[model samples]
Target: MADELVKAGILSAPEEIDKYYLHGSGHFIGLYTHDVGEDPDNLLQKDMMFTLEPGLYFPEEGIGIRIEDTLLVTEDGCEVLTADIPKTVVEIEAFMQS
Candidate 1:
């Protein structure tokens, strides 16, 4: 994401990566409601549920964009629990107009 931000000319240097982008990868979701977070050393195994959210905040431009999705790890891969919902700028705008 930092690389992409750099390519888009959002940041002049890699050192300024955290100036606007706040927050970590995401948190775990369970009966505990955010307990048992993801461990960097361990790979996500089957049955683990979590969220993936990547956001960008540009206060100077008065705009902040965030996209979040819930996922469940499976034997083959991960299942996007929020797949049914509208995402992307076009999809969201169309859904809102409807």
Candidate 2:
């Protein structure tokens, strides 16, 4: 995620991002980012689903955006669940002003 953001000039470097962020939103979405699913030792078997939702918050820029996508893990590959939210600059501005 950091690599992609750096390539797009959205972030100066991966190290600029904090190591951890409080999940103030919630955790019922899926397996917590910390992988504390009541049984941390449990191994992912099959049909397990999760999310990789890291965010960047820059209060100086009045920008607090989190790019999240729910994923379905299978034996073959994975699938994105939240692919409808707009992430572009114009889209976000319109949304905020609206």
Candidate 3:
């Protein structure tokens, strides 16, 4: 999740989730939710990129929180691509209020 955020230019650094298990281990996202959007045998190249989403869905708790972002694999490092979406708590509150 952190990788995705940073690549999208939302965060300046990486973040560590204390409990990532309850909140989705991870996922491979793209044009399709279950299938790979890119080539099947596509390898991680110098400018490769992908999405890393970690989420927690507790229907009983009435809470379904998922953090997703697209990341670009560059020669030097990675880059985020979904910074346009509001994922922060404050941003979410503001959006809901609007």
The best candidate by TM-score is 1
Please report, as a residue range, the 10-residue window in candidate 1 with the lowest summed lDDT: 32-41
Q: Candidate 3 — which residues are off by over 4 angstroms?
A: 1-43, 95-98
> Model 3, 61-94: lDDT tens per residue?
6776768787777887777778778888999899
- Where is model 1 more than 4 Å wrong at Cα? 38-40
What number of clashing residue pairs does each candidate have, in the order they appear?
0, 0, 4
lDDT of 1 by residue, 31-57 (tens): 887668667578989999998987878
Q: Given candidate 3, what's the lDDT at residue 94?
A: 93
The superposed Cα distance between candidate 1 and the true structure at residue 90, in angstroms, equals: 1.0
Of 1 and 2, the candidate ranking higher by TM-score = 1
Local error of candidate 1 at 80, Å? 1.2
Give the range where candidate 3 is weakest over 10 consecutive residues by summed lDDT. Answer: 16-25
Candidate No. with top lDDT: 1
lDDT, candidate 1, at 72? 95
Measured with C-alpha atoms, the lDDT of residue 20 in candidate 1 is 78
Off by over 4 Å in 2: 3-13, 19-43, 84-86, 89-98
Estimate TM-scores for all models.
Answer: 0.82, 0.53, 0.52
lDDT of 1 at 32: 82
Comparing candidate 1 with candidate 2, which one achieves the higher lDDT? Answer: 1
